[model samples]
Target: MTAPAASPALRRPDGSALRVLVVDDEQMLTDLLSMALRMEGWEVRTADSGFDALTVTRDFDPDALVLDIMMPDLDGMAVLQRLR
Candidate 1:
């Protein structure tokens, strides 16, 4: 049998592997997504609350972000707004 297809490659402008931040209130979901992204060879970080997300975003400055809209302590929308 042929080898399984590889995941699509991702890169940043500087030619480094892409970085991603996943924000959600659920620890399980965050852990799951972080594991998946890491398997794809992407840098991954996770935050369990919006407030923590904002702080991590500022420090991490990831290439992409996956956010949950409904969360305690400054929802996703507000986080996006503050970032903008």
Candidate 2:
């Protein structure tokens, strides 16, 4: 294989690295995504629950978020509603 194409790098207008928050109940998935995002030079943070996701979002103020559709404590839909 061609070493799996690397993900495209993303950056802000000022050439600063982007910040990303990944939220998922599955630890493995979260860890994997964190690694991939970090490879693109992004600042990555993860939360294992919807509540924790919200808390981290507030504190970190990330530029982007990757959330699972299903999760305990407060599903993704609920979290998205609350955030909006």
Candidate 3:
């Protein structure tokens, strides 16, 4: 019997799964975002606040960041500014 075909996945240049960081004050939103990215075969991490996001970003160095603009600790714009 033939094996099932695998879904095409987004990989890094080193042939590793793409890493993604989802940052939002809303737990539910982050959960949904993480789920979607995980289904795409990505490495997903969630941060509940902008401060946490910064820490995760440094450690994870994700290929992409999904950030919410309305976080309590720090806003999306501030996070981007700090990251830069």
Candidate 4:
């Protein structure tokens, strides 16, 4: 199978690091994705629920979000709507 598309590169004009936030209730997948993001030289954080994610989003102010579609409490779409 083909690999998933690469996540958009988050960079600074000064060539500094990027910040990433990963939200997924699946602990294993979140951990794996966090590892990959860290390898890309990003500061990564994760949250296991929508409530927690919103808190993280506020605190982290991530340059990009890696969100899961299915989650307990609230899903990614709902979270995105609230963000918008």
Runs in model 2 lying further than 4 Å from the true structure: 1-8
RMSD of each: 2.4, 3.9, 3.3, 5.9
Point out where model 4 deviates above 4 Å. 1-10
> Per-residue alpha-carbon lDDT of model 2 for 1-84, expressed as tens digits?
568887666788887899999999999999999998898789999999999999999999889999898997998888889999
TM-score of each: 0.87, 0.85, 0.88, 0.83
Cα lDDT for residue 46, candidate 2: 96
- Could you give candidate 1's per-residue lDDT for residues 1-84 as a string of tens digits? 999998668788787889899999999999999999998889999999889988999899998999999997988999889889
Would you give me the overall lDDT of model 3? 0.92
Off by over 4 Å in 1: 1-8
Instruction: Give candidate 1's total backbone clashes.
Output: 0
Residue-level lDDT of model 3, residues 1-84, one tens digit each, is: 999998677799999999999999999999988998898889999999999999999999999898899888999889989999
Each candidate's lDDT (Cα)?
0.91, 0.92, 0.92, 0.89
Question: Any runs in candidate 3 off by more than 4 Å, and if so which?
Answer: 1-8
Better of 1 and 2 by TM-score: 1
Clashing pairs in 3: none
Pull out the clashing pairs in model 1. Answer: none
